[model samples]
Target: MAHDSRTPSVPPVRTQKLRAAVSSRLWPIPVFAVAAAVALGVVLPALDQAYDERFPEVLQVYLFSGGASAARSVLEAISGSLITVTSLTFSLTVVTLQLASSQFSPRLLRTFTSDRFVHWTLALFLGTFSYSLTVLRSVRSGTDGGTEFVPDIAVTVAFLLAIASVIGLVLFLAHLTREIRVETMMRNVHTETAATIERVLARKPSPDTDAAAAAGSLSGPEALAAPDGQPVEAATSGFLTLIDEPGLAAVARDAGAVVRINACMGDSVIAGVPFATVWAGAGRFTAAELEDLSRRIGGTVTVGFERTNDQDPAFGFRQLADVGARALSPGTNDPTTAVHVIGHLSSLLCDLVERDLGDRTVQDSDGSVRAVLAGPGFGHFLSTAVSQIRHYGMQDVQVALRLLALFEEVSWCDRSGAQRHVLQAGLAELREGIGQHHYTSAEKQTLMERYQRAQAAVTAQRGRPIY
Candidate 1:
């Protein structure tokens, strides 16, 4: 295979997974904090010994004035108290996680876990405890064997760290309260999802500039493509959380074959299932070539136990939608929260309306199409956001009216009509749905008027881009 400096010969590092892991998991950041604190614990004691007599009188008073035994007592107290506080912090965190999981969507567990504030709070408490413990080892009494010595500066640092940990614990409680709110969760999801959209899609091509969407998405035979191509089976079963397309394309470009991924990002795949297929555009692949190609392709693919917001914008949609769905569930019956989710969904959809979306095609430096991967288009996103809510919330007039309003809100951003048509289809579904519900004549009439306004706007009004 021909390789160039511009092309990656191997799969790129899974930086996205690493990033997701560090953000959502509890240990990664705290481990660094503990290491730094432990080092500081060692270095500060040495400095205290070197500067014991050189310190100015004013500086000396500010440092620890306690004797060696007193210093040991203070250190022990700080360590013991901090370890207790750290345990309380974890308990609070676990309770928050449990409440969020049960009250909202289980998917929202990631939003809470990914909070840097909470992670830093845990880091601070743990760091203070570890620092105190490290410093305590340097505390010695004259009665024991050596001259009484107190690492004043090190004890002072541990004191400062304990104070910081106290503040962190207080702030973490406030932050947790805010995070558990539906509005905050939606905003976080919106911000993260918008960033994902920006990375995956630049801007919507003008109607004349890009008619690729005019044909809509791959359908029927095209959806199931790969006529004479060899199937590339998945190595494991899980959600397709991340894909390294450029690397896959680099491999495909080198092989002179085209790679077509069968599963979209976030789609669940079973092991041994054909998640992709490869067809030679130039020459037939030998059996040896096929085996080697599969190995190369597998490395660029990542399936996981759960979906992540790594490169998959749809994961964000799923989170927001899950929230709305849970809110509308009969057990919860929180129509107001469902309405808020609708607003968030509208924000995301409108923002995405300006971007080119559909099946993403990846090419090499030469502009040769090397990989064709299935993915969510605007329709998928719109449907993902609205469908479940409409199903669950149509009976609630507030949710229905808000959904109607969402169509009109999105109409302003539906400049290309790609999204409005989905909005239009959704409107039709909404109309049929509302008819089945038993509302007052006045309520139904109000709903129809709102629906008609949304319908006309969606059907006839070409939106101006709010970019």
Candidate 2:
């Protein structure tokens, strides 16, 4: 119900879901690389034709001196080798995906798929292969009723590409090996989630704009209840991936309606399910206006097969939690890794506690609240980050203690105490969990003391910044 007045802002032209798709699944960049290489492959041969084997002395040394037969053989060899390498690369990538899914969590496939190293490696191999093949067709032999012609510069370029592809293969192998390590995977996840946090929360709102008009503030949700509103149904069934909040706000402003998004980022919606509700600004929307509004609103909310970090911070937390839980599972029994993961989770949760996070509202030029989006609170974030870990690590003191340390660290950052109850609830659960297991009286005493100290710190730190 609170009206956040702000200036006009432009929403993203492309949904983050699409961006993630482009990066994670492969193909887009390689397609581009192939196109570029093919263009170069076609153009350079023409230049060779222009030279007619009469190159300037300065360029003579740089040109391929091979006869047409040799040039054709070189092209044939390069193309053949690169295609083989490309196939090997794809097979290795598939195996890595399997290894990542089986050894780690299935969710980890996203991390592996999104790796630019792999993308570029594939791009190089495909590009080199396409380039060699394209240039190979341009080579001419006098025996075929044509002047003996060799694309000197083109063949030279192909030779260079073959070398680069060879190096890329070596580098790709090394990079793939490093990436599959649990430690490396977790670190990469932490780094990416940290970036998403900053991008979603840290942008300074321009003062010239209204109260809620911050650079990245429009990037999330803060759902406000819609007691009396019309249902805005979704067109498809899928997980909510991205929303163009600024666009939604603009639509609401135009229709003079208050757009209340009913679903949070990452929520599933079935076809015909109302993911949002709309309230008329004055009285009500005419049937035609309402129909158009529904269509536009549906367009702005993108549903995909899976969740993405684009606007959902919880997805990041979920990924980290999965890693932590997977590590603590008996099959893995890697308490050391779980401990490290908890440390990272602690960092993300602390950021959440210190942040002034809440609902994101977009206001119109008349200072009316046009859009209201719901976002996750500290409770959601804390539980997402730790619930599974706490459950799986209940019997492992190493995990139990690291979790306590996480509570302590988070307590220090939550000087406002806004998340005190959430922290307290987490501690209570941790306490109950420790008791469920056969933690000796001494271990119980130690954990309870730590819990009590955390409670005390939470109380004392209230209304006080630790800085």
Estimate the overall C-alpha local distance difference test score of candidate 2. 0.80
Off by over 4 Å in 2: 1-11, 15-18, 52-54, 202-227, 285-289, 462-467
* lDDT winner: 1
- Give the alpha carbon lDDT tens digit for every residue of 190-232 in model 2: 8888777766654324446534355334433322343557888
Model 2 TM-score (2 dp): 0.90
Model 1 C-alpha lDDT per residue in residues 80-115, reported as the tens digit of each score: 999999899899889989988998889888888889
Whole-model Cα lDDT per candidate? 0.81, 0.80
Find the candidate with the highest TM-score and give its number: 1
The superposed Cα distance between candidate 2 and the true structure at residue 46, in angstroms, equals 0.8
**Stretches of model 1 off by over 4 angstroms after superposition:** 1-13, 206-226, 464-467
